[model samples]
Target: MKRSDESTYSWLHRLNPDPYSLAVNAALLELVPPGLRLLHYTRTTVPAEHLGAFAFYHRKIGPFHLDGIPEPMQREMMFVIWRIIELGGRVPCAPMGLLMRELAETTQRLKTAGLPFQSLTDRTPAQWKAELSRTWVKRTHAFPNPQTFRTYVSPLDRACKILWFTYDTSPWWQREVWDLTMDPRIPRRTQEPSGQKAIHWHTMEPAWLRHGGMYFVKSMMESSQLAWSTAHGAKNALVQFARFAMARGLTSPRLVQDDRQLRGLMMEFLTELRSTPNYGIRNRDKPRSPASIGQITSTVRAFYAFMHDYGDEAAAALDDDRWDGLSPEYLRFWRPGDIGSSKKEHFDESYLYSDADLAKIKAAAPLLGLPRAEGGFGDPQAMRILLLMMTTGRRINEICMLDARPLTLLEDNLAKLRYQQTKIHDAPDTIFVDQEVIELIQEQQAWLHAHLATIGADADPPYLFVSRHNNLRGQNPYLTHVFRTQLTKLVDRAHLTDAAGDPLDLGKTHRFRHTKATSLFNAGVPLHVVQRYMGHTTPEMTMHYAQTLDSTAKTEFLKYKKITSTATESAVDAEDLYDLMLLDTRTDRVLPNGWCTLPPAKTCEKGNACLTCDLFATDERFLDIHKSELVSLDSLIDQRQEIHRERTGEPMSENHVWLTLRRREQQALSTIVKNLETGGSKPAAALPAPATQAREQAGMLGGQGVRTGHRP
Candidate 1:
């Protein structure tokens, strides 16, 4: 065997005496085709590509001798094998032996059976052509993609030519010489003109081109110096418009000069856009969403308006007033609901992560950065970015674009991150992150520093988020999409769900921002405060992120009405409130001195002395509370009576006011206790208690005819 002590062969030579390496190398040499034998290199350093030669031979080309195969078949097969091996292969030699044996057997059978299309020596021209047609049909049916059937036909014909040469008495037939120099999948040519080509503007009639329509677009591009992407979009839209016009035999700009025709054309284009699928190269059936349709309409409208000013000397023809229905204002039908209406219905509530979902994500967060050997994808940067987005509610691009300098180690275990806001708003530049996020950042910094050293000086970047491998190493990687993909994996692993019982979706990373904002609002943070926290310029924009759930509303409204007569006030316990709202579901409740005016867990906007307002329903349940309050009020009334007795002539109006108010409260408590002791009358409907009404009317009339006596 040929061998050398080169570095490439060192590993092989070290194991030379080993049976497995010797067996593998022997099998590879026998399995590789004769013409392809030059591909194997055992003496010098083999390029990374030669490692995959086994798979290339087995998958793309058979291991048959070059002389055994016809000339045409040999050329095409050799080209495909060379191309695949050049890219690199990963098949082991042992499995390659089995695969190559199978391929060799198959090729032998094909060679034995003559060509699928019989030669002219054994059949007439028509008969031979018919056989060739059937063979083409069979091969086309066997191919995966029907669109590429024509592309594969030539190579298959070349393979069949081998059988023809082996059996037929006639000479090789002349055929079209198709190049097998490059893989068909690699785009070798493009029909699009070099640089940014203008639509067929020059082909229009001289009169129409002279009308300034074409010149208008050219001037706009030159004057505004439109961005490359923007100019590209405008050109594409105009080209599509030209195609539409040409199909209808309205090639000249003059054909659409009439207002009615122009308006009709716009309507037809929009309707077509609404129905058309978003035709990608691979995915041809995905329909354009409402937003996409809206964008097309807006672009078309802008193009017309641009031409109206610069192209048409008579600007009034394409003015907003002239083309009433085709204006951008009419394109607003795409988004549902009016601007001021509640945006709650627009999004799927299940998309937002809940507290339980958050817990699951936290548990799964560590697994994101674990090594692949430990069942992880080994991307700690993705984990750190996702955690930052979830906790900070910052935009994906904003977080990805941050530099190491942006992270500040603040006092009191807090960390502040500062980045310039790109949304062009009045929000602050800083965000306060917690200790957990800080720890993640510090860990990433250490890993990055170490990795940079190992990768060499070229792999060190000032940006915090850098790609770890390939051409992207040491660059601002813009890992927002990577963060999203890893986040989805974590979500699936955690099995998170929404309130609606649907599995949560992590596709829209913005949901994390909205989730954080909504949580802050539900925590009773003021709207303006939440706006600042989320770095939103306006309260309206911040409100868009907050959700109004029934549970949150019930909890906050209950706090507003938790009043007491004592100096210290108390609110219902959360468990009690939940039980009252869900488990019990009863409408009746007894207050300290009167009935509760509110429904079970429902809010009362007017929160004051419960005895005064209507809707109070009391029974034996409140007996002890009412009796205790009655005794206290009675003692206070007697003191007021003593003070009134010392006043000259008549008691002061203020003293009468005090006596009347105390007496009313005392009566309410006594009635409640009496009803309880006697096993109660039928429970009262939610109406005003008697004494509360009398005291309120007297006080309203400047305490006129107020009673100073303690009748109760």
Candidate 2:
């Protein structure tokens, strides 16, 4: 190709082909299978160099590795398209309306597939481009907008226009640009002193950036982009800190707004740094940290980074001393350790709820459509939400993320309160809720439904609690702080105070769990059971609560109390009790290994380990019973196959399950034999005693008068 033609091809390759270059080839080709086969079959090629460059750019733009989208994703997409075509049977039009419908269907298919997708590397870049061209094109515009865009371009515009006005004469991309000058809601442009028109660059507001998972920062620029003027190194760390710590309730977003606290914190963090660290911005190549007074002043320099980058005149205003080297200030906090009036008041609830005060909190966030209930706290979700936490002991995140559906009741008719990973330190992903909590949940769900309906809100986010800050303005989507803000208001109104009647001692989500553990322990329920109910991941954590419970002793005494109360029980003498003596194996009396081989009870006579003595001793036939049970996997497999053959009239393919069971059975037998030797057990009527349990190793029976599976 000629240089000019090759250059044009380069431009075409660099160009995003959607809705324009894609028009060169139709979006769909009839009678072709949906995916890569279709892609490979249709699109044309480019040079290897061009393909490599394109691949590099794709990676640069995204987290794309050469691996592309996964195979399962491709298969899923194919299956969906195949199914859609099989049912509907044709390429619908490719215009804006149909294009949108096709894209939506494709997306829905991808979602239902629930698989990672393949990327450009799966096919050659040239072939990928060709496919993109063919798939995105061939659609007609729904209506001519005269601005040259269609009726339905994505609400997220395809093109990003820089506000730099001097670029008007400079070569710029016009293919994806749209004319938004007609919209009144958008900023109106004016001529600059340079006699040039400038497109406006708007400021980014504070929002909780929602993305999935943890990964390392990409570049200094990306880190800086998180905050308006954060030092590049501080950016990613700050983002991570905000996400992880805020979720943990260790930090709050309010920190960003408090200038004094933030400045002081920055100074304190700087003071901790004795020397320069590798992550620095000035000498990008060198590994060092800033140590001079300017180390703190770096925050000041970053204050206007965004405005400067955007060519905004407001950048000049940032030079003010408010962010300069921190001024001396007092560290007086209301918490006890800090030099302030009161310590952090914990939840005590000593403030007696007046007969009237109880009525107010319950009435604060009232039911929707109830008469004389003015719109104050809005929905009753907040109040009922608090009750659900305190009563049910669910984590705040679990409650916040709960779906709008009624609780899922299982076969036992017990309602389940399964939650995904929540903010609680170690709360389990699923919890089967108590019965009373289920009723509370049902009532809460009803209240939310009515409230959402009145407000014309759909339960889109599946959040149990909604707030003005987090929810859509009207018929929109959710924001992050909605539940956090709502709960704060509820706590303030509820008069939930500390033991000392301290006003600020409101409870958090975790406090409910703490209360539940305390209550359960106090009620004499076993700690292990509570741990299971609470879904503790480890027994160690469970023991912490278990230590508080004296249920075992309390229950024994209670049992005796009942026994004494019943005069009829006196008829059973001590002789009758001797019949039920299983030889108490409580830890104190049981040998170290939980058995008794010594006369009376095993005590280390040598002050040595039990291995030294094997003297024939058994006050037992107690725990060690003559177990002749044979768990034969081969027999089980044969039996299973016979049943299967009889039922299905097909031969058995493999006995993989039986094989695994047989190995496990052998392991269990070995463990049983080993434990017997250690306990010095003299078991009764041993294996091979039963005709059913006889193995080839221990043939029928020996010449002995008694069955001789036991080693005497």
Candidate 3:
């Protein structure tokens, strides 16, 4: 037995690792394969990574025997290490710990065999080749991730010291080799790495650690996320938020997610959901998807509260601690996977029309038996409904809920539209109608009056924006289903499109509201002004009206913010943004050589200045303004890709889509952490257990608009 306690065995434990001439290193010129099929480590971190003597040095060479590493692999490995050094790992993934495990096991086996091997050092190059040919090599292909295996390395620390190398040559084939080497010798001039040599890695940074409770919290939350509440709905929301989060290039946001914090939050919510008295929930009568119910309510409420804090003073005023330490009993749950009991028959967007599309539709109404805007006032009435949407930007439901009888036009042309409906239904929000919108409403009323005699003025629906029931009013009703039917007929008959004949998007009626918000801002109206136009009692709801159109709208939108532009090619320079972020990079974070490509490089493949690169970096500005804090942005990108893979199961494209996807992912993760801290996840041990966590992991994000994805 290789006595672990003996001081001489210290090197064996650290470098050699195995006594069996295991595949990692070797004993008597033999390799150790994955022979311990039954053994498992408890409470042990995988691969013994991220700790102890290895933390500072953090990399290793081998008890290096040359068998497992094929000859072709060496050169390639060297080259990769060189690039890793140059790139500072902006490349994202460098699964080093996994690679080192393969090296360690192979080395241990070869060493334990204790065989006297031919010395390649003394032999001629041909002799070395001959001996290599004569030697028997047993190929045991490594695990996909060789780093998962772990050993009881120590009492306080179980992480193993993994090797890392930066080499040059074929980056593809020698990826494993480079993953194993120390840092290569970097040349000073352009800061390139030396060829074919491996030195110790000097990252001089701490390895990412989410230990013990932290790891457990992540595991539990991730596991339960999709299963809780509405699984599928949450999944979609997660995708949206995750994409955004990954694009946000900051580590500070990541620190907020710690283990104990979230575990406690989750535990509390789950416990409360199944509390002894059920927290006075009235609708516990209906069957529910147990896995998601508890966590989803917890998560959403937590997020709403968190966001409410970040909102303006008015929002803060509405926030209530009255339900202090009280878990919100679930009121309603949209079934997971499917978007409720019915399909998307009524929620279709056809009732919505853009301003231009509505104009075209209005023009065509005369041909379809609907009155033209000029004569009988049939099409004109429809026009009034559209103008209302454009002015108020109210959702289709909100618009339908309005009873115009309560609205009175003042001499100033201001329409005082009052209604007691669900605008933050928990509280009362007064609606203020703008003047231009009031005029449109008056036009709609005149059209209605003309049509009222034909359709029976007293027969229209209670809702102001009645759809299929078009002119049916006073007592008769029009449900959303009517809107769908009428909308389908209108779209089919109108044949609306842009002048180029590209079919205009007309399915969404709510878009009139979106259009109102978007158009008002594009016309140089302030967001707050757009907000009042929408009748949002609070600024938070008002902000939702904000948007930037692709190109034209952006140029015009800036004017509202009082930001003047000279029509320069750059609307907002990407380099300028990077410089601001890099203005204060993390302490001791290392940056790569091409930190800013503008300083000029020694004539390589694509040596154009950063601004001209496909992604377009103003490299000179990046260096000049942010040279003091050039962090290797590799990790952020890596985390982004990884989360993307986890959520969408699709790799991102190379274009700026990568940035878009990453930013969302990072934000979702940030939201999760915040919910964990103030919401639940803490005191996880005390909570009443709910369904499995796997559901919540996949399906908890977005609010009432989102769907939950979990099922039995």
Candidate 4:
């Protein structure tokens, strides 16, 4: 082959065929018995390297993956397909749909008719064969000839029955039979049922099934691009709504078609939900919390809205003309006041870890990986998760879902954690983590490698925290329940509790996040710094996590109160004094006699000669401070006066300018002392400088405008 052809062939070869793909080919081929010819199928690919690759058959819904179908299921489905093709029976247009509907109706009839119901279990082989033939001919009208009936229909019916029996009483088996029989041409990735299995449409009342409960789930999951969990929840919620309707004798969708009727139903459901006890026996006596009630109601409201938008198909199928009057606007106006805030505030100190509690946790962390013989039944994964939680302040899911590949260790032991944000899908790609967190992750890496080795080299664990259990191998550690259980044990073993003597509530792993964020905040970490550390997109979220401590609040309040009370005066209130204190020129420039009331913009002409100025006003608050400064000034003046006497050889006061300055300061200090002795009743009151005494003396002596600039 040419190089171009080879490249095309390689691309074609990469298109790994699944059972459904094989089954679709088998159905399409009009060849002879067993139709093994389809098994020799090859893909056709484009030659261009830039264009990537394409295949001959992509399923209707979306393109299938290389290993979309599990090997075991693929083999079983292929065998069924081959056998059908060998029987020379033409494939039906909607093969799976017809087969499942026929099987469902047949099963329903068999139960209704009350045939020798135990005949299959008790009867002879011939009798069983006869019964199978009778049921196939009676129920399924697809069989073309008698030969095909015996060869094709009889065996297909038997296989369906056997599958139903083998799975015991699972209603999903009916769908399973359909799945096996059909080509499953949907070109999408395999969607597994997450959380709980969806309630089968057969179990629900006819109204729900007809009015788009199951159809909605299938459409949203397959076509509308809803996630498996979301689709599953909607399906479950609709099922519960159906059950509620059935109990109230409101079997059909039309009964609650209007907004008013639907709202009434919604109110009734919510009221009953509020009174209903929790599911688990431990909390069985306790009524469902407001948050839980809100979720249930919201789910139902969502269902109603969905039905309103797409219920046209369902309404058209309705036998009654009232559907024309039915507004697809059910529960649009129904308001259930904010359910998220119904519980206690998120900022509870009881949930946070104290220094002592943290120390206990730190000690207990290592005990998780100890052998069971040494009284440790905990997984190392749990310990690592807790460590990450305490240090990173990230949500448990965010840490759990962290990709092993994105744990990049840079120089200086700094590391970056790259992850797809689980809560808000469009959040940042990476957040910087501390070295200690990187170390814990490194330990997890070692554990993961060892785990994969034990599980065999073919096994892949995508996440940082992976389960090593036989059943949940290669999956995330069961943090939802298992991790919490382990943490609770650690808490109990460590005897960790609060100042209130209450045992630590490991109930919320989120407490670790709050504790970490609050700790950073309490340590005076900047809001932006805490935000980045906690992987919060906004500082507000980090602030929310940083719950205020009552002790911190009280201490800060007392400090503020003391400042205010000391500054308050009978003439000037605390607010006025506070404003005055904020003025730029209200500093230590004032003389010991009084504080300077100089405007900040003005330059003082008498810079160092503040003692002679009248712009000064003294407050008792700074009296001691001023007295200390005065003592230092007097000591400096004596030293300068001695130097003046040695240099000039004359009385220092009469000859030196420095002695004159010291005398002026001494005079101001004496006036302050005398005023303080007389005005001892007032505390922290501003007093004028005694430059006024000199001004009074000058006025009496000269009787001219005493050019002293003294306000006093």
Best by lDDT: 4
Q: What tens digits encode model 4's per-residue C-alpha lDDT throughout 1-712? A: 1123222222222221111233333333343233232222223221222111122233441121212223332333334433333222222213322233333444445667885332122332234445445667775554335664343233334333322222223222123211211222322222221122223344456554434554455555556455444554565556656766777887555566455666666667666666666654466668877665656667666655666666666456443333344474563535646234455355444556777777867877888887778888648888888887787777766676676665877777798887645443344557687788778888988888887666443255556676453222354333456678887887788677766677877767887877777777766677788777666687666667554543333322222211111122224343443445336455433233333455567767875555465555454433454455456666766666677679888646544575666677667755654454455444342222213333233323122211222333
Q: Kindly provide the TM-score of model 4 when superposed on the true structure, using C-alpha atoms.
A: 0.52
Q: What lDDT tens digits, residue by residue, belong to model 2 across residues 1-712?
A: 1123222223333444221222211222332242322212111332321121111222222111111233433333233233323222221112223223433443344546683323211232234333333334544434334332232222101111111111122222122121222112212111101111212111111222111001111122234232112222333333333433344343322234454565455444434332334334544445333333233334223432322233222212232222223222222211232222222223332222322333443454343223425545554555566666666666665565565553688855487776534332345656677676787777866666665665444454345444432132122112224445655665575554443465532334465566566556656567567776667877776665444332322222222211111111233333332222224442222221112233335444533222122321112121232122222323454676687789889866655564454444444434443444454444342211111222223422222211212221
Could you estimate the TM-score for every candidate? 0.46, 0.31, 0.30, 0.52
Full-model lDDT, candidate 2: 0.35
Two-way lDDT contest, 2 vs 4, winner: 4
Better of 1 and 2 by lDDT: 1
Residue-by-residue lDDT tens digits, candidate 1, 492-553: 77666655566667777788887888778756578888888788787777766554443344
Candidate 3 stretches with Cα past 4 Å from truth are 1-383, 419-423, 426-440, 443-473, 498-502, 547-712
The candidate 2 region of ten consecutive residues with least summed lDDT is 209-218
lDDT of 1: 0.47
**Candidate 2: stretches off by over 4 Å:** 1-376, 411-413, 423-427, 451-481, 490-496, 543-712
lDDT of each: 0.47, 0.35, 0.34, 0.50
Candidates 1 and 3 compared by lDDT, better number:
1
**Candidate order, TM-score descending:** 4, 1, 2, 3
- In the predicted model 1, the residue pairs found to clash are 52-89, 615-686, 615-687, 616-686
* All candidates: CA RMSD (Å): 17.9, 27.1, 37.8, 17.8
